[model samples]
Target: MLRTSLTFILLTIIFSSQKPKKNGVKDLFKESFYIGVAVNGQQVSGKEAGALPLIEEHFNSLSPENGLKWSLVHPKPEVYSFDFGDAYVALGEKMDAFTIGHCLVWHQQVPNWVFENESGEPLDKDKLLARMEDHIQTVAGRYKGKIDGWDVVNEVFNEDGTFRESKWYQIAGKDFIKNAFRKAYEVDPAAELYYNDYNVWKASKRAGILKLAKEMKAEGIRVDAIGMQGHYTLGGPSLDEIEKGIIEIAEAGFKVVITELDVDVLPRPNNSEGADLNINFANSPEYNPFVNGISPEAEAKLAQRYADLFQLFQKHKDKITRVTLWGLHDGKSWLNNFPVRGRTNYPLLFDRDLKLKEDVFAKLKVVSKQ
Candidate 1:
């Protein structure tokens, strides 16, 4: 009888160990921080029906890929389209997920009329500031209590720690940034406002952002967090550099959000690092080598890269509030056409079929536990 009981007990243990985990990625990191994914228009509009289930299962926060951008949302000065934006917010509400507004001001994708008059002359400082205020009030006010946060300003600083010479800067100077935060706060004081940018891991850019955050705090502006766009490549931006940025930003009394997180497992031209929309390289056969799919070896490397990133995030969970993947799946990733157009890139956690990359998912789960 004792021998039979021991055999049954051992069998039960083995079966239990092999059972699949009921928790998804969000549940795994629920106590640590929010796991988020960017949803495109199709998913929000129910065209990509498969994505809803996957998004609801794994993520606790939602950010629109382009639904809320200035170009799409308010393409022309007299036009404002909220079809996708409304649906996106509704989906977030349905899932009880944290909803994020992508941006209120950016250098790219903005209409030229925003910076110019009816006859194509540039608006003066006061007029331009007025237009900015109007844009903020109208769009932000439309979703005041709905959106949990807004990336109020994006990519305003260059990699060398200097401000970009965008029309906003040229016309209104740095006050445009300050006014953006202030206007956003005035419109919806409850929503968290963030300054988001790519290549933030660079030491100089990090310093510049922190300095701006401090100045805003001193002026009583409500800047809630700093978003480090994790548009990283596999072989660059050493883990140490990323961790340092996280630590310093948190030490500066601002929450750290790993916004737009993705690992580009493709080669790039020399000196191509940040997510500047203007930077484009000629498409060549060399850049599009993975036309079919990545090899097993490349897949393993990608998984390991994500493992390391999640491990770092988990270690600094006390300081980091959210980690958001840039797209729902590899198919929807902007990297596919970025830097070199027509390149097949594998940069997201999910495959083209909307299925989770099991290897990468497993690594993330293990690292979260550690």
Candidate 2:
């Protein structure tokens, strides 16, 4: 009996000393925060064969890419399409992932009919306000318990921090933001409500969001989180800026979410900006320098960039609830066709084959350990 016990004790010590195998992004940040990814219809419906497996393996949260937008979900005055959105919720449930609604109100991707009446006249204050309430209640109510959170309003302010002259502002005034959150809470008080926007690292935009959050709080609005759209580039938004921006929002007493994250690795047609979806230019050799592929040097830089940003994320994990990649893989990223068409941009953790990029996760794993 003593001989057998000694052998078992030795085996247990040997097994315990072995290093644990690294698996997925979610695993790397398991204690820090949930790792999330946005999924299009193809990915949700299993048409993107390889992506769903990666999503199931790595991601613990899912956001619908254009699936839950106003025009796509509630297009006509009397209609609501739950097909795609429902599928997304179902998939999230199956994976036991946190499902988030991209947005409830935004200037872009909304139908013109929303702002017009039968005579094509713009909606007055009362009519527009009613329309907003009905839409939020119905859409948010449909998946009340299923969806965990929402981008209650998106991109309402420009880069300079002034409110955009969107029709929502024109019709409902600034109270449109407050009203949207109120209605969402009324229908689904359990769901987390967030004000999401881009360019939040810039001082002006960050101030604008803080101002909005302040107003909402004073009025007893339910602003649960502030989402900074992490539409980053390879070289900009230094680690200091990312840390500062996240700390700024967390300091405002709001949980921060890194939403819509993707690193663009190509030369911009307009060098002054990053991921301006509005910009459309003629394709040229100047813009599409990496027609064949991103050089290995650029790939290494991309991995290092992610490692550095994730290091910051881990450091601030207490305030950050989730970190979501914009898309599943390079082939599916909107960066491929935006600004200039037919340009191959490597902007995601996974390559076209749905495999891990060269040494990307390995480098990230080392950072996570640190």
Q: Please give the CA lDDT of all the candidate structures.
A: 0.91, 0.89
Q: Which segments of model 2 are wrong by more than 4 Å?
A: 1-22, 274-276
Residue by residue across 88-154, what tens digits does model 2's lDDT show? 9999999999999988999988999899999999999889888988999989999999999999998
Indicate which candidate wins on lDDT. Answer: 1
> Which runs of model 1 end up more than 4 angstroms from their true locations?
1-21
Judge candidate 1 against the unseen true structure and give its global Cα lDDT, from 0 to 1: 0.91
- Point out the worst 10-residue segment of candidate 1 by lDDT: 19-28
Worst 10 residues of 2 by lDDT: 269-278
lDDT tens per residue, model 1, 1-370: 9999999999999999896856788988999999999989898888886988899989999998888989998889889999988888888889998899998999988989999998999999999999988999999999988999999999999888999999999999899999999999999999999999998899999898889889999999989899999999888789999999999998999999999999998889885997998889888987787888898888999999999999999999999999999998988899998998988899998899988999988988898788
Clashes of each: 0, 0
